[model samples]
Target: MKKQLGNNYYNIISEDLDGEIYDLLLTDVNAALFDYSDHHKSNKLPLKSKFKQFLINRLFVGFYLLNKLKKRYTGEMIILSNAYIPLNVPNSVTLLPPWIFSPKKKSFANWKIILIINQLKFILKERSIKLLLSENFKFLVDKFELELGNLFVKFKLSAVVVPNDMAFFEKLALRVAKKKDIPSFVCLHGLPARYNDIDDNRADYLIVWGKGIKELYIDAGVKEDKILTFKHPVYSSFSALELQSNLSNVLVLSRATCGIPCESSQLILTDRSTTLHYTELVKENLKKLGVNKATLRLHPSENEDFYLKNLPDDFFTIDRSSKDDALNQCSLVIGPTSTMVLDAIKMGKNYILFDPVFNGLTLEGMPLVSPFTGESFIKLSNSLEEMKYNINNPNDNISYHELNNFLSIDSNDEEKFLGIMNKNK
Candidate 1:
């Protein structure tokens, strides 16, 4: 069963641990995820590891850890992921990272530094059987280089390909896989964007959505023989159509732009959540200027007390987690970066992505960064008059041109992915 990887993080989470305490905490978490109603008592993990002896390692932790452990224990060995994973073992592998990715440069830098060191160690230590998991289902470009490096490495047929990522993450994975020299494949789930870069550096084989993705890869760079458009392992078929949308009708998406859930890195992004606060202020200013009746969707876990105490009664909040209600109701979606935007599109709703793109540290517990532009709505003034006018024409004020042909996949994603993987296999 899938589970959460709490306690492992010691920053904004908690620092309660000893030397071997990491495993202990993990056991506790796993037990909770597995529904610990009865079975208790465990000094060490019931299952042991191939190398670490303790069965768990910091390298593979979080939601990802559960899947790896499931594989080792021969317990259900099912794909436990936020996205699709490999159906088989050794030949198929997951490609997403075990930890949350930060958009901030400092996190990227630390990751780069640590990765470079790891690469150096891999070279020096000769631990070449490297398998990279799928994508983060959100940030497609976040770890492109790392995946590319993994694909480039020479090993025993390299790592197996698993269905990784859901939406954009899968798209990014496909692009990177396109770069690989080996026979590569990804099972279908949501049809992510087919990056032109992917076709240029196409994998030997691919599991794709349907004729559309197949045609896309062929256009991008994939040889016809390398591409396989699978009948979805999940859905039957799908179609895409654009919805007429407006801006004044606000799309309230979940955003954790507050400062409380801080990123672990102290170097930069220490105060990255200032944008959320700033956004709040900007909204207030807009309201004072006279614009009212915008949707304010709070992140699922966000504390509304501060905003409740400050903002006027005009503001209205809704459940961002409820995918159906928001898409079917709101006009234009707005937030830092969230899956809800994509979810909105899938539901035939228009959206405007708001991304501040922090330079330093990006906090944990925050949502993924939106892939859209920050200045898209700059022309709209904070004045009530401007907001009201903009609200009256949400589509006109914001850039809707960004949501073009690529992201409009209604349901044919799974087929596209599996087609590629099955062909490669």
Candidate 2:
């Protein structure tokens, strides 16, 4: 079937034949397999149709293979996206079906399917064009354990693609990939170990934080061989920036404790989705307390208008130029758990970890599924206040050696991981 589709003598397909062809394409796994030159003249689509086609295309699961086949030669990659294009893209990208994506409907994860496909469609144009999927194929339809047969089918995919680990796509893709024998990659963004996704079968490739994260994965069940690590792409240049020294006295982040060896001087208010309007809440609460002397640093994209309208003029807002700048002026971080808490530790700053459960974990009996505990985690959340009082008092029990061991990273791991991703590298 693949050979027949690759054959040049085959009649050039037309949109008039789209429905019938789509039916035939569905019968064979290779039906939509296409070459760059064979598909003639492009067509524009209405925004609504474009979005519908996008949803259908994601379900197909054949996109990665088709995109990879195109890499046999350097050509243009065409996709459907409203986002800005990446520079140095190997192939050209364009919209095929013009449709606006809607997320309001819930057809048993139809919305989630559309979002992942749209993202891949967007990324494909910049990277190597691989394969394409039919509009309705899914790797794991439903279940935690993989259906061995479908898992094997998915293993053949050139890449096990997923948008974000939190997207539920991560758990399913990794499970399928594990059964089929392939690498599964996950991108992490500041969600704590709250999700039990640390299973050994979680994923093979992880885009996570520094060395601490790698150990976390190891502890979770991922074998060393199945893991790949890299700094978040957003933080690749973090080490290169000059550290701003003259930080302000007011901090916007949540995890901070005063009077510690690394105590913070800045007044703090961390952002949570529950308190996007925290400034207003803070103002009201402060007014009740009769206190009015604090500066506010924003949590990136909080809705300022809601709070501004309610607050008085004396309440100043800290407009951090960027995430990096926010880090500089931050006095102390306050949160239950965060990768950033470790970052603060790395920077030798003061912070307070306010875990919802202290002196214990959410998992009472199962350590594998339990939250952080023991000396390593206690340092961030439970010990900060105690350490503050004992400033200048040395304790041989403070296992700095163990802490360094846990935090240290094998720098050579990056080259090793890239070697795996790019066979020729």
The TM-score values for the models, in the order shown, are: 0.38, 0.42
What residue runs in model 2 are displaced by over 4 Å at the alpha carbon? Answer: 1-163, 168-182, 195-200, 207-211, 229-248, 254-292, 296-321, 330-336, 342-349, 352-374, 377-404, 410-419, 422-425
- lDDT tens string, model 2, 1-425? 11123223222432333432322222122222221221111122446756877776664434333333442322333222222221122333332111232332111122344454455444333322122232323232332223322423422232343434322234444555556565455545553443323222335665444566666666755566655445443333222212222123333342211110110111121222223343444344334434445456444323344345544575556454664565555644333444554454445444343343324532111122222443563343334344243222222212345544444456776676545434411
Worst 10 residues of 1 by lDDT: 260-269
Best model number under TM-score: 2
lDDT of each: 0.39, 0.37
Per-residue lDDT of 61-174 in model 1, one digit per residue for the tens? 332334323423222111212224334333344333322332221111123324433433233223111111112211223354464445334222232344542222333434
Predict model 1's lDDT versus the native.
Answer: 0.39
lDDT of 1 at 122: 31
